[model samples]
Target chain A: MFKKVLVANRGEIAVRIIRACRDLGLKTAAVFSEADRQSLHAALADEGVCLAGFKPADTYLNMDKILRAARETGAQAIHPGYGYLAENEKFAARCREEGFVFIGPSPENIRLAGNKLMAREMAAAAGVPVIPGSARGVVSRDEALAIAAETGYPVMIKASAGGGGRGMRICSGPEELKEEFSIARAEAAAAFGNDTLYIERYLQNPRHIEFQILGDSSGRVVHLGDRECSVQRRYQKLLEEAPSPALDGVLREKMGAAALKVAQSMNYFNAGTVEFILDEKKNFYFMEINSRIQVEHPVTEMVTGIDLVKEQIRLSAGECLDYDFSSVPGRGWAIECRINAEDPENSFLPSPGTVERYRPPGGFGVRLDTHVYQGYSIPPYYDSLLAKLIAWGPDRKSAISVMSRALREFVIEPVKTTIPLHRRMLADKSFADGDYDTGFVRKFIPVDEDED
Target chain B: MAESPKRLEIRAPIAGVFYRRPSPEDPPYVEVGDTVKKKQVLCLLETMKVFQKIKSPADGKVVEIVARNEDPVADGGLLMVLETD
Candidate 1:
């Protein structure tokens, strides 16, 4: 275990990592932007270093500043949390070179998984069901068109360097493709500073499911379970549930096995997520792999009884997984709803303001993770997520019921939230019956309908 | 739905507890009847853990203080009332 750990990120995830470090008797340091000097994470950590300005490039994403902070604070390890430099292969390499432990997967594994194009090729080579499309970055329109014709219509163009719904576009035909390609390239360049794009067959109405894979320094890897992140808006996950309602015994085993293959192919270590898209007919195709602990990890933790953050730290320190892999199969069902500061009623616009009332959900089987309080100011310069509410039960129905009860008990005043939307979702028969898809939210929450 | 003076209320820029001064020992940023120029720091709004200095948007007199020091506020919630000349 590290004597001191530096969290190279901000917000709730940062808070989460720091708390775990504290529990393990390890001193923790937090790095923050000028805009987040008073954030909960900063207050909770043993110490905090201001990275730089409000923008990501100057602050949490500032590699040099983060490394300097770790060195100055005498931290033995750096936990990149989820975003910022979490999945950055170059940062991981730098940490290894500096002789500081980098929590999560190794740099070589990150090198293969950070770039979606490479990850896809690796998956294909591993005999995983990867989507058929471009073999590499499509530089020319002609190349994209060729790949599109070969893969069939409704192709998806994605950024090779980043994910989280920032740089992606879908085109149904050639005319639309030509019009969209430039915009997609521009968005990708602005967001990731790398306009490298790739093409893939766009599976319509697919269930966005991901397998949580855990690995140790001994090169042993195991799959926890699958999380269904199908409920989304603009590619941003709204809700995630583990032991995906769509997964049957046969399909679960197949997806879980394929996920382990992805990890083994890269010799992946620590915590990572291998995402897939399940088509309407239950056929699954490999999407990209997230090279860090995802926001939805709580759902997996709920059923598996594993503390992923602690596991990541332990594995990074050369410890083997302490349990029998075969005996640790996930049990029960878990669901997590992200309570963002954005208002669902207002087109999900970022709602940065003061939190007048802070009342989190409580009771059995309800877990609320947040770094906020009644007087906490919502910063405009970062992600809008305020907290996460996770619930677990013996079955999906019980989990939904528990989540509904938890959401009702939860209260954050003066700032509009998606709580009401969640309330509606839990009550809807389609959602309750697990018949909902990615389009379920949009179909249920129609903009033009008058709320009577 | 005709608007009223209450509708044009000034709000805090971010979410956090309202602070009257830069620090515990400092005087309050502004009080009712005080004249404020554009870009003048009105109060400190602390969010997450950052202390942000909320500045006046226009030259005006602080007519009413809707949110007190150390009180929690919502995004877009009225923080003060300003009367422009």
Candidate 2:
């Protein structure tokens, strides 16, 4: 095990990693930007380094500075707690070059998974089911139209290098394709510096289910289970739950096997997520792989009784898989609501300011993961995530009931939050019946009523 | 001087740490009473590991420096005051 590890990220995830390291008897070093001098992550770590700027590139994404801090702190490893440089292949390679263990997958695996087109090809080659789409980048208008017709109308034009819902357009008919194609191309060029676009058959009302897979250096892999992350706004997942209400024992086993296959194809080790879009007919299609710890990992941990962060560190330290995959025990359902500091009433504009009052819900089944307190000022330079409120119960219904009560108890004053929106979502009959899809939030939360 | 010069505030365009010099070993970009031309580099706003040159909007004399070196500043925070003739 690493004696000391440097966390190359910030906010709740950084705090999460630091706590894990402490529990494993490892000292932690936290790197923060100038704006995050008083951040909870920095205060929690045994040692802290100020990277001297507010922007992500200067702080969390500054590989040289982060590596230097690790060296200075004598940290034997670095844990990138998602986002920023967590999925950056170069940063992982640099850690190896600098002789510090990166507590995640190898650089090669990250690079392969980072490219959408290549990842799809790899998934298909591994015999994993993928969505029907063009074989390569759609070059000319004629080719795009042809591919659209073959794949059927309602095809998705996506950037080859895109993620997080950017550079993507869903066209239902021929007329919309031309305008959407050009617009997607321009957006892709501006966002990813690549005009390369691919076409895929759009699956309407699919449930976004992802399996959490963990692997060791010995090439042994196992999956924890699936997470239902369909409750999203603009492709940003707002809520996640384990033991997806949609999946049964048979479907769960099938998805788990597919997730393992994806990991095996790359010899992927450490913690990673294989995302699949499951249609209403129970057919699952490979979406992409997230090659790091995810924001919604807590739901899996709550249900499976697994410390994923500790597992990542142990695997990176060359430890073998300690648990059996086939017989992994699971408790009842767990649901997590990502409480972000955004005004849902005001088009979800970021609400960054001092937290005049702070009170988090506490009960038998509720857990709050956050880095904020009274008087803590939320800097507008980073993600708007304020906290994650997870509720675990004997069943999905109980979990939802507990989450509803817990969300009502949680409070953060002055700064508007998505708490109200979450409250509404929990009360909605569709959400309670588990009949919602990825488009649930968009329809549930109506457009600003005052908007022209 | 027929009339007092109009004092203009040079505010930060983004939230970051304000640096008075390009590098640690170099002298400050400008001092009180230093004349600057339009688009001349006044100071640097270091954010996301990128050093953005904060240039003067117009020819002016530096009258006051509000932000200290390495100060964490918010967007629109005053960095310095310039007197335009």
Estimate every model's Cα lDDT from 0 to 1: 0.84, 0.89
* Candidate 1 vs. true structure, TM-score: 0.82
Q: Per-residue lDDT of A1-452 in model 2, one digit per residue for the tens?
A: 77999999999999999999999999999999988999999999999999977767677889889999999999999999988999999999999998999999999989988888888888999999999988888887778999999989799998988876767899998899987888888778877878889999999878999999899999998899999999988789999999798888998988889899999989998999999999988899999999999999999999998999999999999999967556777899999999998778766766677899988899989999999999998886788898999999999999999999999899899888889999999999988888889889886565855332
Error of 2 at A231 (Å): 0.3
Q: Write the per-residue lDDT of candidate 1 for residues B1-85, one digit (tens) a residue.
A: 6533332357976566688887666789898889889879888776543456777888778888999787667656688888765
lDDT of 2: 0.89
Candidate 1's displacement at residue A174, Å, is: 2.3
The reply for model 2, stretches above 4 Å from the true place, is A448-452, B1-85
Restricted to chain B, the TM-score per model reads: 0.85, 0.94
Off by more than 4 A, model 1: A186-190, A322-325, A446-452, B1-85
TM-score to true structure, per model: 0.82, 0.85
Best-fitting candidate, scored by TM-score? 2
